[model samples]
Target: MQLFIHQMNEEASNDILTWQYDRPYDFYNNERTDEALQEILDGSYYRMNDENNVLIGFFCIGANAKVPAGNEFGVYNEDLVDMGVGMNPTYVGKGNGFEFCMHVIRFIQEHYPNKAIRLTVATFNERAIHLYEKLGFVSEDKFQTLFAQFQTMIRREHQ
Candidate 1:
C-alpha cells in the first residue's frame, strides 16, 4: 500500500476531528473547535492518504505532538522529535497499522534526520505500544494524567 503525505487542509482536518473511536480510544476524539482546526492548520500536522486518495490518518510533530501534561513531569526534556498519530476509526484494528506507521516513520526520518523520535501513548493502549516497540521505540518514562496513564517511548536516531 502506497501512502501520500500532505499538509493538513481544512477538509482533512474536519474529517479527522469527527473520527470517533470506540471506548478507551474515544479519548482521541476531538470536537470541531476553532483551536483544534488552527492547530492542524499551523503546519505541524500532516494528512496521510492511500493510493486512492482516501484519508487514512494524520500525524503531527514537534510541540503539537507533545502531551501538555508531560511537561510537569519533565518527560519531554530531551530535544527529540515528538510524534502523534491518529487513524480513521474505520481502519482501527484492521491490521494496517504497521504499514501506516512505517510510512510515518520514514517521513519523519527524511524530514528530521539524526534526531531521536518520541511518542506518548496511553498505557492501556497495548496494541499501539506493541506496534511502537516493534518499530524500535523503547519505553522511556511513564506518567499519569487526570484521565489516563501514559507511557513515553523513544526510538533513538541509530535505531
Candidate 2:
C-alpha cells in the first residue's frame, strides 16, 4: 500500500484525536486534550494516510517524545530518537502491520538518519514484538510500570 506521512494539521489531528480502538488495542488509542492538542500542533506528531486518502495511523519521533506506552520504560539518551506509532482502529488487524512499520522506519531513516530509533511496547504485545524482531530491532531492556511490563527495542543506524 502506498503511504504518505504528513505533518499533523488541525483537521488531521482533530480527526486523529477521535480514533478509538478495541480491547488490547484500546491501549494505543489516544485521548483528545489541550496538552495532546499542543503536541500535535507543535509538530511532534504526523499523520499517516494511504493512497486512497484514508488515514492509516500516526507516528511521533524526537528527543522530547513520549511514545504510546508513556515513560514507563524510563528516559532514553538524547542521541536516540524515541519513536512511537499507532494504527487507526479500523486498520488494526488486516495484515498491514509490517507495511505500516516499515514506512515509519523509512520515514525516520530519511528525516533523522543520524539517530538510532527506540520504542517501548507492552511485553504482552507479541504481534508488535514479532514485527519488530522481524524488522531487525533488538530487545535491549525491560521494565515494568503499575499497569504492564514493557520491552525496550532498538534498531541502530547500522542495522
Candidate 3:
C-alpha cells in the first residue's frame, strides 16, 4: 500500500483517535479518545500521519516523556524522547508501520539534533522489532508493559 507522510491537522487528528481507540496493537485500549486527540491537535502532543491521501495511521511525539530512567534495553539516560504510533486496522501489515516509523525517525532526528530519539516496542512484536532494527534503532535491554505491548527501547544514533 502506498503511504504519504504528513503533519497531523485537526481532521486527521480526530480520525487517529477514532481509529486507534480500540486498536489491536495498542496496549491501552483507552488511550485514544476525543480528549487525547484534541491534545494532539492542540500541539501539547505532536502527531504524524501515514496517509494514502487518507488517514491510515498516525504517530505521537510528546515532551518530557523521553527515555525512562529504568529499563532492560539497557538505555538509562535522559537525553532522549519517547514516541508511539498506531494505524487503522485496514492498514496493518502493509508496510505502512515501517514507513511511518522511518519517517518519524527522520523527522525527530532532524528536529531534535544532538539528542537521542527513542521508541518502545513490545517484546512479542517481532515485526516491529525487526523494522526498528532495520531503521538503525539499537534495541535496549529494556522492556516494559505500556497498554499491552512488551515495550523495548530503541535509540537512534547521531549521524
Q: Top model by TM-score, which number?
A: 1
What's the lDDT for residue 10 in model 1? Answer: 97
Query: After superposing candidate 1, which stretches have Cα over 4 Å from the reference?
Result: none
lDDT of each prediction vs. the true structure? 0.93, 0.81, 0.61
Each prediction's TM-score versus the true structure: 0.98, 0.88, 0.69
With candidate 2 superimposed using the best TM-score fit, by how many Å does residue 104's alpha carbon deviate from the native?
1.2
What TM-score does candidate 2 reach?
0.88
C-alpha-based local distance difference test score of model 2: 0.81
Ranking by TM-score: 1, 2, 3
In candidate 3, stretches whose alpha carbon ends up further than 4 angstroms from where it belongs are 1-6, 20-34, 44-52, 64-77, 141-149
lDDT of 3 by residue, 1-159 (tens): 455566668776666555543334554343567676666775534454333376666666754233343344554445576677666667677776767677767767787776666776666677777877777777765545443335446575643
What TM-score should be assigned to candidate 1?
0.98
**Local accuracy of candidate 1 as per-residue lDDT tens digits, 1-159:** 789999999999999999999987888889999998999999999999999999999999999998899999999998999999999998999998999988889999999999899999999999999999999999999999998999999999777
Model 1: clashing residue pairs?
Answer: none
Which residue pairs show backbone clashes in model 3?
27-147, 27-148, 28-147, 72-141, 72-142, 73-140, 73-141, 73-142, 74-141, 122-150
For model 1, the run of ten residues with the poorest summed lDDT = 20-29
lDDT of 3: 0.61
- The alpha-carbon RMSD values of the candidates against the true structure, listed in the order shown, are 0.7, 2.3, 4.1
- The digit string of per-residue lDDT tens for model 2 on 2-76 reads 999998888888888899877886776678999878887787788888999889988888743544444544545
